[model samples]
Target: MKIILKVLLYIVLGILALCISEMLFFFILIHSNNTEKGNKTVIMKTDSIAHSKALVVYQPSLMTDSTKNVAYDLAKGLNSKGYDVTIAYPGKYLSTDLSTYKVVVFGSPIYIGQTSSVLNDYIKSVNNLKDQKILLFVTGGADDSEQLNSLEKLFTNAEIPMKISFKYNDKGNENKAFNLGSEIGKE
Candidate 1:
């Protein structure tokens, strides 16, 4: 009986140790991901609508849900110049009508080396803009530029009036992209 109890105790300890290690690993991963996403989320509600009067739709969507980091400086730059801005992600609402917005900006994160399905659907749904203006802004890492540039060409060829910009892992790129947003608003 003593030997059997010892074996059972050893097995339980091993399992407990494994569980603890797994929990620690998962906790670390979740913590890091949250921190990264938190920094990006700072751009949300960044809509300074006083600059440009155009509706700005910034979407950061995975296959799961769509969210956005509002380009406040970009929106503000345009709004400051007197453009009205309305911002949203697909998750906020869906099947949105583009007819109401004269100038529309769609901001998307790079996914699988390309834009998300939500942005693609938005572009496809926009069949008759007549005189509507469209702009696409993309956020991605360094190697993503080639992919982003190519993606921008797709939007431009489709008459989206894209001012393609890429945000590398480096923070400065986002600022650069923000400046590009200003140009996009101007155009």
Candidate 2:
């Protein structure tokens, strides 16, 4: 009986440790993303003919931490390349006029083998984007690039015509995507 009680105590302690670690990771994510005070930025609206500006929206899974920063990295790089780029977080829950940007980038992390609610909301926000040059990006926690194909499908179903898309590691993989954004801006 005493041994059983000891085991129970050990189990309880183990659970507590796990919870603390998880919470630490969550706090870290919130802190990392707190790096900037976000602003609601707007670019010029594209005409019936596509414009030279671009909008990139990134939505990270609520459970994840690192995905929140990639969109900014991509945005800064594109800006360096002389692209009019705007980076917005989907959590702002704010909608922008999609007509303002020639290219709209919808990116998010894959949770439960699919895109998160943030991306879904962003997709829903776009209106009358027919023939618009859309781009898709995804960050996966455990799976492979297979997650990106589904993201592309989501854009296709939403009537977003994607010109290019790519997936990269959520941890420290930003330069390649930045380069990609620059190239996309040039197009």
Instruction: Score candidate 1 by TM-score against the native.
Output: 0.55
Candidate 2 lDDT over 1-187, as tens digits, reads 9999999999999999999998988666544433322455544332324336678877654554445556766676556656677677664445646786676787776544555555665565556666457767776656535666655555533454443333444344577667776776676
Single out the weakest 10-residue window by summed lDDT for candidate 1: 35-44
**Model 1, span 1-187: residue lDDT tens:** 9999999999999999999998987565334322222112222222444432466655553322222433454565555445665655533233345666556676666654655555555555544555667666666544555655554554433465555554534456545645655666666
- TM-score per prediction, in order, is 0.55, 0.63
Q: In candidate 2, residue 131 scores what lDDT?
A: 45
Q: Report how far residue 87 has shifted in candidate 1, in Å.
A: 1.0
- As for model 1, its CA RMSD to the true structure in angstroms is 8.4
The lDDT for every candidate, in the order shown, is 0.54, 0.61
**Cα lDDT, model 1, residue 150:** 59
Backbone Cα, N, C clashes tallied per candidate? 13, 1
Best candidate according to lDDT? 2
